[model samples]
Target: MALLSPGRLAALHQMGATETRVLQDKPSDSYERGYAEDVDHIIPSPTLFDSLRDQHLVPDDMPAISQCATHLELLEVFHSLRNRVIQSRYLDNAFNIHPSKRIVYHRKHRRQKKVGKELRDTGFEGRREEKWKYYLNIATARFEQWIQGIDTAMNDLEIPPCGRKVLPPLDVLVVWHAFLLNPADFKEYCLKKRLQHVQKIIFPWREIHEAIDSTTWRFTVPADQAGWILQTTLLEPDLLHTLTEDSHINYLARDLLRNLSESRWYNLAANLRQANDRQSAFMQTIHAAINNQIEHRPLVENVQRQCIFVDKMHAHRWIRSPAVQGTLTRAVDKYENFLELFRLYPNKFLVPTLDVDLVWHTHQCSAELYRGFVVDRVGRFINHEDNISRGTLDTGFTSTEEWYQLRFGEQYQVCLCWYCEAILSAVEEEEVKDGGSWEAVDVEEIVERVGEEVEFCRDLEISRQKGRRLPRWKHGAGV
Candidate 1:
């Protein structure tokens, strides 16, 4: 397996698919004849960039795109290219269908029986803490595969260098979605890998949301686009079959899976027969330390960090509990206010409550949707950065809390969990000691401190506000 480069395997895969298609069409009894006819189809298909550009040759022929058309609309219409009409409709849709809303969408009958079965087969069924360990391990492994698969596909296949992107399978998409939430980390990963397809990759958020057939549970795309995906990536299993029958990839490229299994860390984490009690505890602590450093690092180096938090939350039902109804509703309301806050003070470094963050993260899972929704409302792209230090987060959260309340007449620290409560208390105490107030965020200083943190920050032309402090709210006994 090691002898065959990914490119060679890709060529073979293309030939095999071409041969099968020819045989099906020709009803060939002779293998030789079918193989000979397969030569024509094996020629590289036009890249997605070419296909999209060809589709929109006549502007009049293009379909009516969403009013909130931003990059998503541009990619759909001009294969490249926002609006105010989009503000109401797009914002409503973003909040309404954001991924986090699905956390409790059908959890009542799904959790203990269905979800448990899913995790059970993945070797994560166990005590709460222990389950986190196994879920993290499997998630991390899958993320590794995704990164490699994308890199390999881009290098080997004729995927567009900068255009509409091909979607990966759902498991890979989950981790990819999380990774893309941190734009800096995602871009750094691309830059470090020297990946050319970074510009070409665009998630089709609108298409997926609108085109999915509920009865079939299938995302319906043009047959050409589906064929493009089959030709370009290793995501061959039927989407419906994947959803209803098995969430696991039973037919993953054997060599790639073998290499993943051979890695020492993956082997240690996945070996179900090993002494897991102590090992899981040890690995869990190590995972925490690793996450601290890799919070905003490249996916290749930080797959564990990328997957662990998400998988851990899922394992504990934090992201999928039926009790999430009110929380998600509040999240949507708060997310609307959060966007409004940004529109009012576009230059401010306002932090969000956990509820708002949840909604924000969900919106971002679909990159096209997020860009269109945010750009329409805020007049610029808002990158959700999580790589800031604890001190920075505390200060920003505290100041943002006050500013949000002042602007919206609502409390921002809504989560009553012990962890959130403790953090809020500490930030409030620190503010009192310093006699601090909500000051305007230093746009230049922040940009310089975090290089390329916001890809479009410099391009957008941030307006500097006067350093006037907002009215302060006295906490507990006055200092």
Candidate 2:
């Protein structure tokens, strides 16, 4: 025979009284309540042994024999006799069903409704009952497992330092761990659950820094959750400072800064002093002189009015200051030479004395020259009086005699003033018509013309060897 512990006996007696009161005060309308109370006593009977067994609190090695069976039957009788007490305490008060079990119940009810409609429509009711039983068994098993899980989790809860005391809610611990795993999802769950006034514990900065540096830190949090973490904790500072100080960090700091600032992480801006400083310096140098002369003129005037204004004589004296005159002259000369070269070959050269080949390699000559000269020439050529378009010509005469014979006639004498003058004037007119634009002419045409001229000169040389002496040619003079 097994003896009950004092505590277990007390619990059983308490349950008895609670069930007794529930039965005595039971309303006539609640047949299910009475039925449930009877079922509780019949199946997992609410006796001390039954309660111990259901709770898994019974020790092993207890014999299931005649005396034990007698004890179990007697315990079942006691549970029925004390039904009202158990009903009041556990049956009436507690839902006596897990939430997962409740969900299963609703699901089964829906499935049953669907199956009932189908059976009525088809007149096939044979499998309906079987399906219901199957679903019921599955639901029952799942409910039991869910309850077991809950019990195990409860058992794992740390005992208070002082005997049995109320522990923190299990949901709170769940939320904390969920936040550890994924703060973003946890935050959403909290919002959906309407858990108001939940005070989140702020993690220590060093711990957070370690988490970030570990390379395994989860970045799955939603933007809002990240914003919350940054706002409530020191995460923003740690992240901003880490990225700011890291030499290997990419040029994405600006983007990060923008995101942080937009999210109201204003403190991060403080750590970006160096970046801001560099940007300020660049802006100042790029637009400073213009800004000073125009936008900030009032301030400039104020400074000039307040400070000593040096006259031209004083400026000259300052310019001729022995301390800097030599350096200044050398710098000015270097700058002047540079400007001249830039004007002459604006695209090809930056510095006058630098080797031409170096500048040619450094800059594109055609593009620069076109930009500086051709663009300006377009406007000038449109306004010019001489309508002569640019033309290309090539000549390859070994002697002046060949050139004269080609342009004038082979028999033409220098004494023919009209012809000679016309030829000279035509050459002058051609030069004037060109507007001095080198790019306007066709280079290919010029090369072809030069090749033809070279061949003609060779023919002329052969003719001279054959005793065909061409006269010496001149423009507007004796031939």
Candidate 3:
């Protein structure tokens, strides 16, 4: 028989069966002169060898076992062959077996067979220690491979120093070899590294300490070794408010001021007068309106608190008279123009578009009461020059197209003026029939109408927010 392959020897060691016997007698011995020990099976028992083979405990190309005198001699001869195949096959098989089974196999078999009768005489404690040592060696080798895998994965990512370097958990290797392999679980292991907590783990403790010691790194202060750091250090609400005020983008502050002004809240009005004496007349008017609308109303009164204040009697009178309606309509147009100016430069003012809309809607509704003033006459004689002029005004490159190019550095333009003009003309004709002058409309009512109109426009804009109508960029297309 051929000598056992290294893989078979290792498998024998793994299965706790290493004893092999071959029949032999010295010719010089008188007692054994006529007798001979017959040749029997060598190395691992047939049952154990079958188990190892079924579990793929040895490499396929390894030779079958042959008679040998000692386990140590067998081990030496086995290791002399290409040990790579043996080591690889052992590791590959070991990973498939349950960690508990591996532990038990080593304890009951490998050491007992290697030391022969001495190990068999030793108690379970001695065997257990031997098993632990065996596992430690295997774990150390496996850990080296685990480290290599981590390094390989990291290199494949090729992330820059400034960019994120995601690291897999060391625990994953422990779990993978200890338990059944799972492809799905492996993917989840990768995702956890990208999160904030795991990202912190990638930095070495020494490097973290060095960063903490640096005076220039201002955001976080180091905590005592035993204590937890508070994340709330940077979340000062008062400081945030101050920053917003300094930046002039405090929308809440603007809204509060607007509401106080529109409702004519006198205490607030007095406070504003003291605080900002250089306030514009427009602001003063808004403040006075807020005071009258909100502060003066009786608590028990059942009247609807109008979102925008308007003179009801004046609105009724305007609705009755065409001349009044025409005047109200013109006032609505002017209010819209003022709103558009502010909308185009929202950042310059602290006011929100919603606030502008609120004011505009109130004014528009008041103007609507004057609809009786509009005339519904259509002229049969058309002036071609007027048509050409109107067409030119509507057709000339749209401001929106020019603005789009300026803002986005793209030449894509969709002519919305055609649609805008149609809407504007319809509103204009309707306004002429209601009332043509601006002064006849109540200022309060116009403000109310303007507010409502702004809200309507805002809603329309939001509905269209997701659609991107811009054309694709072409070569040589410059702004």
Q: Which tens-of-lDDT digit does each residue in 1-479 have in candidate 3?
A: 01123443344333211111111111111111111122121111222223222212222121111111111121222122212222333322322211232112234675474432223333433333232222222222323233344344445544322111221122121222221112122223445434212211221212122222111111122333112111111111121122124333232224433343233234445445434322322234333334343322321011112201122221122111212222333334333443343345343221112212222333221111111111111111111111124344444325534543455454322111112222333345545766874334343443333333322222222222223221221223211
lDDT of 2 by residue, 367-471 (tens): 222123323532221111111222311111122234334443432122211122222233333446688544444434433333332222222222332444322
- Candidate 1 displacement at residue 205 in angstroms: 5.7
Give me the runs in candidate 1 sitting further than 4 Å from their true place. 1-165, 187-230, 235-297, 300-303, 306-329, 343-348, 372-376, 415-479
Q: Please provide TM-scores, in order, for all candidate models, with all chains considered together.
A: 0.38, 0.11, 0.13
Order candidates by lDDT, high to low. Answer: 1, 2, 3
Ten-residue stretch with the least lDDT total in model 2: 380-389
Residue range 302-418, candidate 1, lDDT tens digits: 334444334333222222121233334455667888888888887778887755665676566544446666888788888887656778888988888888899888767654322
Find the number of clashing residue pairs for candidate 2: 11
Arrange candidates by TM-score, descending. Answer: 1, 3, 2
Model 2: residue 12 alpha-carbon error in angstroms: 99
Q: Model 3, stretches more than 4 Å misplaced?
A: 1-264, 273-282, 292-479
Candidate number achieving the greatest TM-score relative to the actual structure: 1
lDDT of each: 0.40, 0.26, 0.26
